[model samples]
Target chain A: MNREKVILLVEDNPDDEALTLRALAKNRITNEVVVAHDGLEALDYLFGAGEHEGRDTSVLPQVTLLDLKLPKIDGLEVLRRIRADDRTRLLPVVILTSSKEEQDLVAGYSLGVNSYVRKPVDFVEFTEAVRQLGLYWLILNENPGRV
Target chain B: MMDRLFSLRVRVLVLVLLAVVPAMLLMLLSARDRRDASEESGRARALQLARSVEVDYMHRIDTTRSFLAPLAQVFALVPNLSNVTQTACASFFDKLIANTADIFQVGVASTDGTVICRSPAGAESAASVAAEPFFTTAMNSRAFSVGHFEFESVTQKPALHVGYPIIGPAGTVTGVLYAALDLNAISTDLGKTADPSVSFITLITPTGTILARYPNPEQWVGKEVGTPPSLAAMESGGPGITRESVSLDGISVVSATVGLANAGASEPGAGSISALVSVGIPKDQVFAGINDRLRDDLLGLLAAALLAGGLGWFGSGVLLRKLQLYVGTTRRFSEGDLAARAGPPYPRNELGALGRSIDDMAVAVSERQQEIQRLNEGLEQRVADRTAQLEAANKELESFSYSVSHDLRAPLRSIDGFSQALVEDYADVLDDEGKQMLGRVRAGSQRMGQLIDDILQLSRVSRAEVGKEEVDLSVMASGIVDDLRRTEPHREVEFQAAPGLTVTGDRRLLRIALENLIGNAWKFTSHTERPQIEFGAEGGPGKPVYFVRDNGAGFDMAYAGKLFGAFQRLHAMDEFPGTGVGLATVQRVIHRHGGRVWAEGATGQGATFSFTLGGSS
Candidate 1:
């Protein structure tokens, strides 16, 4: 059931997005990764509106890797909306970004992100970080969706 | 010079005396003038009294002479006195003596000193008239003569004898007619006309004999009046002379004496009888009233002056006390006690008005002080508002840095990550130089990331709030050294951090500062044969200069000014690889703790980084 659960990747920059996907592939995280380019697109996908209309909204991600900087509706606002909605209130969210700013970490935690990781510049370190995240959330940890 | 001594009381006393003294002097002057006028009037009164007494004496003598003149003419007409004519004269003389109270005796005497006829028959007659001065004077001078003053044997009263010479048919003196006038009777008559202020009236002979004295004729009539200042004046024979002297009766008197005119002098040589009339008024009696008034006026004036001086002295003291209170209150207010006031319970006079004015000024000054204080507070509020605006701008800058940290690093990571991926995955397609170029790109991107991280850290140190706690610098340095050792366990570096080195500052910031300093010491000393790093402090507590020393590739003293600048490195990247921001971060952290940081070194010798956490250390 955890293997069938989805991963949400909310990112804005294409380079960072491509690097992140490549890192996930290198780590062998076989779970389906749903890509949302901006904060607004991620929210739309979660609630099954806009381009994701007619999609089932009850299906929640196993883990959401959210970047703080985005084009539309910013990441903290999307997090606020996700936590405010009862459907995605308990969903495990991870903050994955290049920034190690204190405000960003504090705001991410305060907004109910379960895990926080700085995306390392070295591809090897990035691949290792993604492997740990995938093994912990998908294999070792029990899914709240099964409950 | 004596201004302090001349207090209000003294000034008031001086003013009082200034007002009183002139009045006192004027009063004294007027009193003196009054005394002079009183003395002049007294002398005039005494002179007048003496003149009046003299007139009475002369009238008596003139009356006697006139009565004798007719009888002499009668005798001159007959050569000898017949019994019929003598008997008729005797009867007439008796009648005259009985009628006249002034004449005590009347007689006719021959030149041979035989009594021819007597008016009073039973009276004892002197055997010879030849011894009598009046008879001799009248016979020799052929004129009427007045005798010296004497006391008669029978009456024991003073008298003056007057004689007229009788001329015969052959023009030789034959007989004399003489009369003795009672001086007491004359004095009694004069007393009736005398002034009541006159203490004594005296008839004095030219020889200084008291012929008669009024009020006590019997005691003084035959006594010689000693030549006192008054008697000497009388003997000078002036018409009238006044003297202030002690009289025969031992009374202080202002006496005037005048010589009486000899009314019976028929020739120049016949004017031998010189007499005087003197009147004395007691000196005290003359000026007693004026003296009494002057004394009373002086006493009253003295009392008034005393009262005025006393009022000025003590009254001014009262005013001075209040004035001092006002002065003290004003001084205190000026000296910054804005609440100081000349408090309540004011006097009801001009002094009170002055006090109220002072209090009003104090209140006004206090209000002005309050106004100034309020203005200062308002200025402070404006400063606080400006500071808040600056903080907002700073917060915006921090957020912008945060965005840069996030956005700039993402592309950097991609560049490095992709270049790494290309080196690993596309190894066959890439030539060695191409692969080397990608490796350079990877190194450049990684270095950029490191620079960005170090810049963010320095900015974080700038923005961070410094928190205070006990930070053991030696322990912190040892811990950092331990971490460095663990990273490169094979390096046999000698670390010497002073034991128990401590300070009071922001713990995290101090730790970070020590980490940077000690870390630099460790890194710079890595190439040395036997690397040694020493962390210690000098100076006193709370003012210690902490030092991190390293036997390493030290910097030149010439470039010391640029040592702590961000991105400033003394050595090349290949020699001692660093981001060149460690010392800058250390400087920032030390500065945030209100401290100073400095570096000392000689190239290739060693380096020492020293810092002081200001006074808070």
Candidate 2:
């Protein structure tokens, strides 16, 4: 039996978060989905802070969806912190934001965020964008030391 | 003086008087001499009558003496007394009768000097005496004795008596016989000799007795002369003539007196008894002939003078009329009537010359006027052509501006949209480097779109009509700064927006200007630890200016002049993300509202953008 992989969704907009979850579901990759409201909550779940405590880090989510515009810690800072730590230095991060600003994309890529995505304004096109991201990062992609 | 001499009337009058006045004066003087000669001939006839009277009287007296002498000789020879007396008386009476017809009266005295027989028969026996003075004076002289003139009883008239003494046979004492003669008949005959035009002539005896005068013989006969100055002057000298004023027959006369003397008498007293003959020509008759001739001459001169004056006046008027016509035409031409020409049929003189000059002047003036009219029309045509060309050029420029603003932006937008779409749709098919390169392509496309937009906006500002509205610039600047802070929330920026700054301009356009200025501030200050921006107004009234100041990567002031030019960039693309059309757009917006924009900056210190919107209220 093949064990299903979990994907972490870190997005500020509810619409974008739902679109990404629907794309994974439509692709038949029924993995466990953990939703974080922003970059701060995603960090908390990884570090076992206030509301997300005592989480096992060895069974980490396969990929995190980080939105650039978050409430407290921005997506780029979260990505920097994860790349600086040895335990999550190799974690897969995809930057998903509504802005097509170049500075944000460059800063996100330099901080070791694995992929940068601009959220589409059209809902059908946004669903396609999420579908392609899921197929490449989860189905067709390979990560090291996976059980 | 020239105006006076130029008159035609004066010239004509001078010419006429010069030829006519002297001719009339010469005719008057010659007529006066002819009247004087006619008066002198009357005086010469009176002198000839006086000489004839004297010659006839002397011959009668000499014949009487010879007859008496012969009778005395016969009486002495015969010695018969009765016969002798009868014969002597008969012979003497016959001789007296013959002589009395030629003379006035004749008388004979007896030879014994006692009695005389007179030819007039009444006086024959009146006196028979030998003691009478004529008998005594004749008996004592050898020649006949002439007695003094006296009044005679026989004729009752003035007479001269002549006596001859009788001589004996041996030439001893003898009887004297005398003859008596009346002088009035001879003087009466001499008075008839005067000419009728001559005045009365009077003959006077030397003893101042009046003899006879023409036209008044009865009043002057037997009257003694009253010793007139003419008579006194004639008595004082031989052959003397004098002019004297005298009263004759109770009429005043200027008488000329001439003394009558015996013929060939040179001695003072040798039968040279003084007789004064006076002939008078009155002054009225003497000058009457000359005055009639002078009156005719003066009338002729007056008529000639009037004729000359009339001709001069008519000639002058003719010349003046021609001159007045020429002057009137000249005046009309000077008053801009070039068509005015002189009248035809002018005189052949200076007036004709003047008319020709006026016609020439009119021709010249009309030609110049025509040329000027043509030049004015040409100038107006040129101006109209120029105006048409400008209008066409303006229309072409308007369409070009519209195309730049509306059409040029469409392609840039497509490039940016398609590039952004590639990154979003094809992100999985690309590797990391390919994705990164696509990101750079999208970024470059977006930047190019922004640059096109900025350039289009700049063009639009220059082309658009400015609509004015009151804008609170301080608030607008604060709002823009707030917007910049929110655009990139990580940046720490300080804003100092001055309060109470208002200007009248297009609010939307001014907003664009402020946005560009503030955006530049924000972008350039990105490298600073604490970015600061200030917006305020400075300077006084009539020169109030607004400024945007930033602590940023200021450019060198040497290249600052190019800041407001379209697409002029100062910083490298990696340092400042800009199309470099922001300030150019600001400049265009300000200039559209009739204002100016400029920048002041230095390398690495700060930059300030100052502009004027020509504040309207």
Candidate 3:
């Protein structure tokens, strides 16, 4: 196997996380994807603490997909933490949520998340949202100084 | 006194008397004059009868003298012894006596005063010879003479004697021819000349002796003429007449007398005889004619007066009765009974005029009363309608306030909750610029939430139904100040709350009002070393007023007018954090309790807010 690229998925709902991973595998952008469930957990994972300790530091994720509502913390906090850290400051962050609330979108963009996406109520539209987010973060956009 | 003076019946009666009295007086005076005229007429009639008696007596005497003159011619012829015949003298004398039957007797005597050739031969025995006044007077005189009146022997009635001398050829006395003229016969004819209403004729000798009287001849014949002044007056002069009241036979008589003289005598002579003829009207009978007339006149006057008086009284009564009815109706109308009306179907006169006016007045009064009633009803209806409109408006305002509170708070909560979540979770992913921006957003959302709460509180004040309870305004104010201190634990606020400042009002609303006022003081005085707020009672008992006063962020008094308006902030968010709706909500709460709120301040000095919850302490 070629050296596997790592992807971080910051989602709170377990059903949405399973659907997003399935859409990435069908789109043939299957990489070593890690799930954090909340902003606090995502931050801990990136900094390698709690369950993320002893993981290879050199193998940081190429992109992160964020949900706005989460347990223990929220998606916007996770994105803010990611952009504030020096190691993950330049990393691409995508905001995803089932809510169409306007303030959440504006707040996501204001916190320097690369993109914002709303999870649709229909199953097909939700799967398409996951597919587009994975392709843009994993394959389409070239992250600088990345191997 | 007023009742007597103003009585209507007295006025009517007085007016009736005023009109009737004069007419009655005139009738009485005319009746009296009529009676007097009738009495005077009776006296005149009696006097005329007396004059007739005098004329008749004198005429009979004159006729006898002429007869004797012719006999004297015959005696002269016999003395000359020519044409002397006994048959001729006897026949002529008989015819002369028969012709002078009204005379008592007619006879001729020779120059020796012996009676001869007497017709109705008994007359010689009935007549007196030489002792007769007429016979003696004729023998003594050369001319014819009339004797004094006397009662004749045969007739036993009043008689007047007359004598004529029979002279021979050289005018010597040959015979005295005498005749006794019955004065009663003349008086009987004179009585016929006057009405029988107590008229009497009397024949008297010129010596004033009573001779014959037509009425009561036997009784008056022998009496002297001194009783009636008229009898004495008749003997005084020739053809003189006088009127007098006399007592004849113990009965009062009104009489007149006239003197009788020989027909050819212009001067008094022994050969000429004068007699008095008097007529008397008994006093009762003299006035009897007038009495009848006066009685008739009085009766007529009484009837006329009664008729007039009755008519006047009845007319006045009818008029007054109608007038009284009208007056009564008018009185009732004046006392506010506009429906009062006069009696129906009266005469058409001045009283009718009054009735019509009263009826017209009643109609006007009824119309005015109806108009007043209609106006009152309309006013009541208008007031009811306005009250209903005000109630409806109050209900609508309450519902609107509830909607604003509920709907506005929900959205603000969502915005704040999501913004807080965004800052906590997304801080790691944000750059310095990003983080700063997020901090601003979160601050804005929190501020917005506070603004919504303040606005909702203002709305609640405007629309809340005030619940009444006895509230201790000073304790409520102090409690609010303590709560505000806990909200900002580092802020220092001093409270001077008067104890036992009780008020009757909505406790919840009053506490809300005081909380806003004191809370504003707490928030505005965050920069001050010590902030002071006061709560106390103002004014007097029964009208006691509770007021909350604050010394905090004092604003310009020029702008104080806007202090109670919603969202009117005197301080910016950076200078003093507030939604600017606290004082507005306080004003609305105070106003809902029928109180008043005001503020006084300058730009750099502190603000003092004062509010009154008007109620009994």
Candidate 4:
């Protein structure tokens, strides 16, 4: 177990962010979560630029839960930028959006997302989805360290 | 065929020839008749001239015989030889020869063939007369005899000698008295009355020797001629005979001949004389007048024919020019100029009527073309406007669907999530009713979210582009049924699908249609003791009617029409949980593929939903 395993949550809606955090906590996932209000903030936290300046640029999230609709740069553009960079290109990204639109799913996958999961309106289903995502990426899925 | 092969000019020429040929033939026939009449007239004129010459010769011969008969009587009365008798006979002959114009000489010969007396005494007045033909003929027959033409001693001119035998009182022949008739006097009398058309006049003896001729008589007189065989016809002495032959001078003439009968012979039974009189009209003079008329007539006919032919050619040109106008108009029409016409300056004839008819047809055709063009333009504009309106409606629908997918679901998620947190985190303070209310709020918010999702799905089906491929509807139905079974493992639903339900359509759209139809059947059949669902096809190839049938909670047939309408539910939510949008989405997919969907049902019995894809199976 890597004690510094971090989860990135990119969401523009405060209510959805709160719901997602509660869902992860309820699933007993104890990894430190870095919350970004929008696509640009998520990119800033990962690259240690903007408000996250002077931070360790080498540190990357274990998994990124991306929302498709966000303020500033959209989720698809942020994912494109993440894949474009060598440090974050191979980072595990799961699209956790309130949209089940096929266009968003296709665009998310086309931009090199690791998984696409639609956010369920049922709170229980949302909690179960987060728990499975944490188990698969933080524990069961093999990761190249520091890549 | 003739009209196609020949032009209008040729036809007109043919018509002119039709009029000309028979007219020329008739004129030629009349000209031939005129030529025959002229020849007949020329022959008649020659025969008349010949008859006139024969009459004059016969009258002169009769006159000479009358004079000689009386003179012979006078000599016979003084038969005894005496000098006084000879002198008296000589003076009497001299007085007789001087009184008569035709008689040039008179002489007396005794039976012993010596000249007893002579008048107009010449150096050869005592010449022997026994060798004279007239003297010998008169002594043998004792009749008046006509002699051959010879030169007289007294006159030295051609003359005919005639002799008379004197009979003594004892009824025996005594001496012969003869007279020479001057042929010049006879020829001069004939010449004064000769017809101008007569080219030559000839007098011939029985021996075929010409005694006298009028023109150039010196060359022709005393010459023996081979009498023309045609002169034999005149020997019968009925009428003169005319024949066309070459004369002694080699001029072609139509000659008429008449034989003169012997007259004034002492014996009544003396052989008849066969002296012939011939008059010749040269052939050039015979035909000259008629030929002139014929030449003028032929020239006139030729000029008329030329004038008619020239007029025909010119008239045909005028007619052909009128026809050419029609041809040019028709050619322009074929080249797509519908406005071309053969009219306005029309001739006042049948051709003008035809031109007007052609112009009428052109006007109708041009108007019809313009009308069709106007219709075509109107149709194109309508189609363009309809396409633009369709595009705008589709754009509005797309944006609306996008908003439903993204913004509408977020609030539902927040509502349900917070309700869940209340129920979970505040368990001790919250009463069971409070927790139950939170659960109800969560259910309502989740149901609203599901409704939004269903609406989005239906809109997406409407907006998505349909792609074509072969899809096995039966296999897809089976797959959907298997999924239903997996989702509700405890439910004992009997699902059966017939195989080989294949069709050509958008595979993804058809799959979505099939899922909804079969899913509806599955959900409707859940409460039955032995729930049954079936997927199969009916109808024929290329237009197969597919159906999903269920034997579960069936609605009344009265509400069947509303089955495919969006949000029109026949069953309550408690009985069958749905957004009531599935059938609408299925209907949209079927319609997008150019098909239709319908449902049939009876209360407490069953429902069968049937559909067809456009023209593929």
TM-score of chain A of each: 0.95, 0.90, 0.88, 0.95
lDDT of 2 by residue, B6-62 (tens): 566877887777766677656655664554453344334444544454555567566
The segments of candidate 1 whose C-alpha lies over 4 angstroms from its true place after superposition are: A1-6, A39-62, A71-92, A110-112, A131-147, B1-14, B77-88, B97-101, B204-210, B216-229, B232-241, B246-251, B259-276, B292-381, B615-617
For candidate 4, give the lDDT of residue B581.
Answer: 96
Choose 3 or 4, whichever is better by TM-score. Answer: 4
TM-score of chain B of each: 0.87, 0.52, 0.64, 0.66
Stretches of candidate 2 off by over 4 Å are A1-147, B1-91, B94-102, B110-115, B124-151, B161-182, B206-208, B235-255, B262-266, B269-272, B313-342, B348-617
The order of the candidates by TM-score, greatest first, is: 1, 4, 3, 2
Which candidate, 2 or 3, has the higher TM-score? 3
Clashes of each: 1, 8, 22, 0
Give the per-residue lDDT of model 1 (tens digit) for A1-147: 356778999998888888888888887777888999999999999999999998899988888999888887888898889999999998888889888888888998998888899987777778899889888887887767666
The lDDT leader among the candidates is 1
Candidate 1 vs 4: which has more DockQ: 1
DockQ of each: 0.63, 0.02, 0.02, 0.61
| Candidate 4 per-residue lDDT over residues B1-617, each given as its tens digit | 23742466676667777877887787778867876786788788888888878777777778988988887787668756334356666777788789888988888888877877778643355657888878888888878887766777666677888888988888788888888888877777767778676788888776777778878777877788866565556555456687788888889998888776654345322235546788888988988876787788778877877787788788767767778788889889979999798878988899888888889889999999999999999999999999899989888887678777788888888899998888788899999999999888998999998888888888889888888888888788888888988998998888889998888888888888888888888888878889898888888775788899999888898888888899989888988999999999999999999998999888878889999878475
User: Model 4 misses residue B253 by how many Å?
Assistant: 8.3
Q: Write the per-residue lDDT of candidate 3 for residues A1-147, one digit (tens) a residue.
A: 122767888876665676667657656676888888777888888888878887766567788777776778777777777778788888888776644434467888898988877554333445567777766676677776474
Better of 1 and 3 by DockQ: 1
Q: Write the per-residue lDDT of candidate 4 for residues A51-70, one digit (tens) a residue.
A: 99988978788889999888
Q: Give a tens-digit lDDT track for model 3, residues B1-617.
A: 33543454466556666765776577667767865675577567766766666666656667767766776675656653223343455556667667565665666666555555555553434323677666776777677777666766666666667777777767677676666676666656655665666556666665657776666666667667654444344434445554555545566676767666654354754435455666777777766656676577667766765676667667667766677788788889889887789957857876687798779878888898999999989988999898899889877776555444434434443444344445556878767887677567656755765675566567666666788788777778777877776777877667798888877888877777777777777767677666776777767666665555556667878788888888887778799888878877888887887777787777656766766656645
Residue-wise lDDT of candidate 1 within B40-117, one digit each (tens)? 889899999888777777788889999899888877776764332445555667888898878988888877867767
The whole-model C-alpha lDDT of candidate 1 against the native structure comes to 0.83
Q: Candidate 3: deviation at residue B513, Å? A: 5.1
